[model samples]
Target chain A: MSRQRSMEKILASEFVSIGELVRLSGCRYSTLKFYTEEGMLPFKQEQENLTRRFPREETLVKIKEIQDLKKQGHSIPEIKERLAKKM
Target chain B: MKELSFAQNFSVIALNAQDSLHLTTAKKVFLRCMAAATILELYLDNGFKTEGDFLILNQEDLNSPEISRYHKAVLKTLFSKKETLSEQLPQYLKKVTKLSKKMLKEVEHAFAVALTEANALEEIPALLGCDLEYVTAGISMKEYRSNSELFSRLTESLRAETLETGPMTDEAILMLWLLRESGCIHDFFSREELKRVAERIFELQGSSSLAKQVFPITIHKTIEMGIKNFLKSKKDVMSTASGSGINFVFPVIERSQSVFIDTEKVFANKEERLRDIKARLESKGHIFTVIREGEVPLIKIDNVLYEAVPSAKLYRIPVHGVRLRKYPLSL
Candidate 1:
């Protein structure tokens, strides 16, 4: 599977770094950090490493869902509650 | 965050609580100030020289990357015919009107971009409608409140009693003048305080670095006179059109599509009506050509020619509760 697959396919199989998430979502790095801290987005990190990795497709969808809730005039806490219930 | 220019800052201050542009008398004045301030910025940079009554462009300064697109558009307008005298300010405005509006739109977009970069405003393309051409975003309530506070600070800074200090900064003077000319001064000052505010503005004008440049003041006055004359002429024509000779004050709706202008408001005089229609169409994103075939102004929209007139039939739009007349250019 590794030998036949393209680099993009291999990369998409695993989690994406913060920068990749920023590029994919068109969101600022700080906003991603905020979402992570608020528990609206989930991330994984390796032992003894500082880098944060987000599940690419799920994070992108969650960002859109949060923004849609915001457009509907939801507060941050309310958005968190809604996302919690949805999850 | 990138620091905004005085003109850009003026736009932020003029925005209403919802972050949308407030289409008021202040908007007209703001447009004029944006033009004046951009020209003055170029003048300060030695890109334009005042020769007697005309402002002659220095073509060498036109290519600098530091010069903003708004400034460059103003420079390009001045470059045509090599110079723009005080008397020609109205025509100069007409040529640069579209670019000036784009500049206004750019301010909001630029501010939104800056906010997103700082992570203050959220930039979700799907929800916020961010696209290739426009980068719209959602402003947090916190940011909105901060903006309101900033506007209050600006208002407080210009209080008549606060002018005990002798000389004001150049930006302050320009902002003061913009506020006063826009009739927004009434919003911030009482009748008694207005007299003092006017005095302070006059004093500031005489002392500011802009006054030393000369042509900016000339440009402001010429534009002011041009507006006065245009309004006076419109009033005379409108009164004449009424047949009762009573001057009916027409409400100027900000959105052109929802405009409820009376058919009688359309002047019988072709030239006058042509000017009014031309302005109305241009505001709705239609471009006009300089060449007028015969008496009618030729309006070109996306390579098609169409005459715009308000239809006679009035129907009720329950949403706005105002009578809607279909403007044919939109059809």
Candidate 2:
């Protein structure tokens, strides 16, 4: 199936692409990528291109949490440690 | 016929604009959408500060819940069926907020562009109306026999639709534009009065009324009719928890143009009042030659010939050498 068809096939419940992630999160791709690499933001690495896609409601909730921590002036490492320790 | 005369006690909109700049619901919503779109465009263009390897939002951004929610809402509105590298081009933003990609139906990207591109606030609703032609193009895609026919039909429809919307009489929108144009942030209880004054300035600046020695009656009458029309138009009812209206001025344009609004041409008597103004101005080294035009006398001040409008602002001038008037513009 074509990309458009596949996108149409997936319910609204499915995770969207990294570019869409950038849009929804209002964050840069490289930032999200770095965060993903450092196990900061939650995501699934599926598909042939190993492209990142996030669950709809989960991404929003997680992003809000990350935003709250960031507002408190927590660095990426500290955020990682805090989120990691919580997990 | 247009006429020019030395204006005394001309109406003031600058300083007065602070007390009355209020945006109606529809105007406020459209402006909010435009601001959000501009911010989104800036973000997509990587215009923010570079945080080492990653891009951060604005350095000064508080990233508070309110702003975050706003960003989230804008982001959620932006969706694409297929991923393309050039989809979010910063400069090529004309069609960036296309209808198909919009998750929310009401968040019009075209409206955003039209608003951002409009030099005057009056043109926003009109341009948005023009943009509606493009929006309806999808609907009439099969109706038109040719592309030219399609465009002509669309223009015709949009023109009619915009007229039906009656944006010309929407004072809230017009007042917002006047507020921005006059460099005022706050609006007042006397906002209608301010708009009337600003409109006169535009008319006076225009070539249509250039060098014309007209009565304050002519200017005031035209503006009065316009204000009445705006007042009669339907008010935009927006459902937001925002304040009633702007209560502060950004730069606070000073009340420079002193007014003495003469309803009965009482100042037109011009025996003592005019002499007082003349004597005071002459003493202050401001020389002016008075000329009689029609029934009323005209005076030249700073080379601009104007007839005075009586108001409370020009109260310092001694009326009968004793300041006999108990109230402004009453005697």
Candidate 3:
């Protein structure tokens, strides 16, 4: 299938790109990327181009957890450690 | 002549010069900007701070005489929530917008009262058949005409490539920021001038120690980011929000027709198509006089006035005066 068709298939499965995730979550692109890079959120990367696609449900839940932890005065490293323990 | 708070200045500008400023922004977007401006005003007063992307109230300053009871109440509401007020800037902005919706009438009243006290408010006649108070209906307008000099200065500053020399006033910068957030900046500057104006606005914003102290980025950039996200979600709503109404500013013709233009057309461009329309009409022994020409051109045929959009095949019709939408006008 073409890239467009593949993207549509992923979208049908509720897998979202970073841009779509930003729209869904109302978070800034930079903030989301930070979360992704910190391993606070999980994603699958396409080997062809390394394009990251996130499972929308899992990503949103993880984002909520991170936000709640941040509000409670946890730093990024602490939150990462906490999530690692949970995993 | 007197200084106004950021929200107050926004109200004065938005309400006073809606048409002259071409404020065709959706009411929701306007309300969001008002909310953001109000929040920024409090931020400047050191009433709130950011914890990560979330907003946290400075509890000690809740009782400060500088903060209004309405503002204090909003702060208290956020403070009482055990959880953070929002997950991020855009969500935070959306929360405050609820206050704007609730207090819009109060805001209008307060600003109107201020303008009246300043001897700056003049009540224009209400539209015919609209039996409503100026506050409720927006039928009657109260233009605050005394701030002409201030208006000129703000417009001139936007047009200039650099921030005006010396310390730019906080109120001035805040008003400019609010204008940009409300999306009225486009009406004030052409597409070419907008890029330069946007840069100058950032430079002006950067010069403000107060804003730098309050926000990680300057308040303008923070609000701009939030507004971008907000607008992205609101694109569909905004495109349809312009109401159909006859504007008193333009000559209205009783009769009109809607025409659809071919997307792929023999006309090279909009201007060429408009020229062709004029030629065709004139050749039919009808007098086609161009009144004002731009993206939407106002033309007079024989004796009737009509506004025509070049992209739309609408050759002539009595203008309903609604803003020409981005989509082609089809009937």
Query: Where is model 3 chain B poorest over a 10-residue stretch in terms of lDDT?
Result: B126-135
**Models sorted by lDDT, best on top:** 3, 1, 2
Which residue segments of model 2 deviate by more than 4 Å? Answer: A1-11, B1-331
Can you tell me the CAPRI class of model 2? incorrect
Q: Give the lowest summed-lDDT range of ten residues in model 2 chain B.
A: B2-11
For B1-331, candidate 2 gives per-residue lDDT tens digits of 1110001000012111111122332233233333334343344334444544343443234244434333333433333332222332222222322323233223332332222233111111111111112223521111001122222222232222112211121222222333332222222214554555455435433422211211121111234334433432311111111110111111011111221222223344456456554554454344467654332345564433433322222345432121111111111
lDDT of 3 by residue, B1-331 (tens): 4545556556555554332112223444554565566676665554556677565655676677878644554455444545334344445445544543345444444455665565544343211111112223443322224355444433443333122223344554555666766656765666876676666566655876543433332223355456645644443333332411221122132111222222224434657546655654543345457777766677665444555553322326322212222222321
Candidate 3 residue B175 C-alpha distance from true site, Å:
3.8
Question: What DockQ would candidate 3 receive versus the native complex?
Answer: 0.01
Candidate 1 vs candidate 2: the TM-score winner is: 1
Measured against the true two-chain complex, the DockQ scores of the candidates, in the order shown, are 0.01, 0.01, 0.01
When summed lDDT is taken over every stretch of 10 residues in candidate 2 chain A, the lowest stretch is A1-10
lDDT of 1 at A51: 51
Candidate with best lDDT: 3
Per-residue alpha-carbon lDDT of candidate 1 for residues B1-331, written as tens digits (9 for 90 to 100): 3345555555455433222333233344455555655654454444545565455555666677777656665555545565434433334434334445555455445444543454334321121111101211332211122244334434554442223233444555656655644445565677877787767666645665453433243223446446744654553343233411222123232122122222224234555455555454444343345334334344443333433332232235211111122223332
Please give fnat for model 2.
Answer: 0.00
